[model samples]
Target: MVFPERFSNLPEYAFPRLRKLLDVHQAGGDPINMSIGEPRHPFPEFIGRAISEALEGFGRYPPNEGGEDLRAAIVAWIARRYGVHLNADQHILALNGTREGLFNAALALGVEEKARQKPAVLMPNPFYQVYAVASLAINAEPIYVPATAETGDLPDYVALPAALLDRVTIAYLCSPANPQGAVATEAYWRDLIALAERHDFRIFADECYSEIYRNTPPVGALQVAHDMGADPDRVVVFHSLSKRSNLPGLRSGFAASGSGNIAAMKQLKNYTGAPLPLPLQAAAALAWRDEAHVEENRAIYRRKYQMADEIFGNVAGYQPLEAGFFLWLPVENDEAAALKLWREAGVRCLPGSYLSRAVAGQAIGQDRLRVALVAEEQELQRGLLRLHGCLYQ
Candidate 1:
């Protein structure tokens, strides 16, 4: 039997690779997991009641597109958060999670043959693994751009060669970026939107971490696009309840794009997607409608950030995060640093290289480790202190 060549060169998923690297060693102290970005915050208390009330509907099939009420709730949230009003019927589609929507959108909209050559999908080096998988699934070439400190930790697609840009079909961007915690500026968004328009590619803005910021709320891709009067179809932003409402288990998220893109995605979903179950949809609606819990969750993250700052502040080469929940600390080598931390400190973290690939004559994430600040306050503090002592001290 022949295996697909598309996955032949693909690296093992992060967690499995991590286990292989550290499973042989015994932790030196009590374990403190600061590795995965799974939120440890409390979800809404009302989710159970909402689910119980709507449980009967589960016997029936869920709508391929989201239920009207759920869609409206998402619309309202978008309006409140981004000031971009979306038509629930035309511009919103609830997802199992943003990952599903993000991956499926590529299949729905990414056209490899339409480009002057084999289409290229642009993504940050240390990107969400789904972006590369989706690009490969569609037979498009995935171009990994370095999102290192030299580039402000955001991929500069505008800097790509015109020949490559002309062949580009989609660009995946993450604001309050994963593992690195870097947020793109409004000016950055404007430049990117202009590039997309000039090159005729769509921007898949993955803003799942939009709600988990420190200072002011991060500027959104849709908001910037709308302000510039850019073509709505040029940018499609994906948001989720996972980080925002501390509801990762709910698998609730939505995509907001131009009517045409949304329509195309809806049609594709009708054939291959399963929308949120009714009870889950109801729970998500309530979650979206409430901001109090989100604020509370933000407070928790803020506290953890301060704890990380206090613990790692004196350590040389520690780059305190500006947004998102991860600390991207410079080290001699990510894999070795991660192993040492796990073995000596019992603190687990991801090697930065696992999140990125070498591109344009540089191994973009070769000298850093990504420490997720998703544990509880006390645990997070202890983990940061251990990381500081193990890696920096």
Candidate 2:
């Protein structure tokens, strides 16, 4: 049996490739992982209690669309955070995680063809892996725009040729961009939204790391769209408990958009989506409603940001993160730097090329590496010290 050709060129996922590259050499000192973005902070105290109280719901099939309480909680959070009021039942669908929503939104929403040709899907050169696969799965051209230093780490669809923009049916973007930690400001969103309006494409805004930032909270795409009064169908905003609430295990998130888009997603989900279990959904609702836990979580990240600045302050080109936990540290050779860090410094970090695609024969992240600051204070500090001494000196 022959498989589809669309995924033939896809590379191995980041982590497995990293293990192959580093497992041969023994770590030079005590092992510390600054690779994955998993949060090491103490998860909210109430997550456990909430799960225990809702255990009985597991005996029944979970709601495909979120239950009233869970949806209401999510809607309330949006209002409190973005000032956009939405009808909970009509405009939202709870997701197992935003990854599922991000990928499936492409399936449910992207057109197979536009202007009588295979449509295009736009994404940052180095982005969440799902975006590329989502575009390919739908048989669309995956346009990898440069979100590099020159572009301020956000893809500029506004600069794309009008002919190409007209073929775009979907564009995926991440704010507080992973690894880079760059955020799309309100003005940036307005320009992007205006571009979408002109070209008639949809923007899938991945705002998973919106809560953890240094100064101002990153603006939400949905908020900007609401303010501009863009067509309701233009933006599908996805958010998650994984980063915001430090609850990746909860597998809980939601997508909000026009009721029409929600209905299409729900229709697709009804047949194919794996509904988040009822008990976890109940617990997640509590997480969304409570801002105290989120505030504490953000405070922890802020402290880490200060710690990073103190450590890397003297290192030229070390960008103070605007938001999110990862540091897109510059290195002469990312793979070589990663190997040296593992062999000499006992620190494991991801090579930048693993996270990005090549454009015009030049890989976007070949000269950099990603260092996650998700570990506890002392451990993360030690790891950062090792990284700097091994590579920067």
Candidate 2 overall Cα lDDT vs. reference? Answer: 0.92
**TM-score of predicted structure 2:** 0.99
Query: Candidate 1, after superposition: displacement of residue 158 in Å?
Result: 1.1
Tens digits of per-residue lDDT for model 1, 1-393: 887898788888989999999889999789888879898888999999999999998898999888999999999998998898989998888899999999999999989576457889999988999999999999999999888888988998888999999999999999989978999999999999999999899999999999888888999999999999999899999999999998899999999999999999999999999788999999999999999999999988888878887887887777767788888888998899998898899999899888877767678677888888888787787888888888776
Once fitted onto the true fold, the runs of candidate 1 whose alpha carbons sit more than 4 angstroms away are: none
Q: Which candidate is the best by TM-score?
A: 2
Write one digit per residue (lDDT tens) for candidate 2, span 306-355. Answer: 98898888888889988999999988899999999999999999999998
Top candidate when judged by lDDT against the true structure: 2
**Cα deviation in Å at residue 116, candidate 2?**
0.4
What lDDT does candidate 2 reach at residue 94? 97
My TM-score estimates for the predictions, one after another, are 0.98, 0.99
TM-score computed on alpha carbons, candidate 1: 0.98
Cα RMSD, each candidate: 1.1, 0.8
| Candidate 1 clash pair list | 126-355
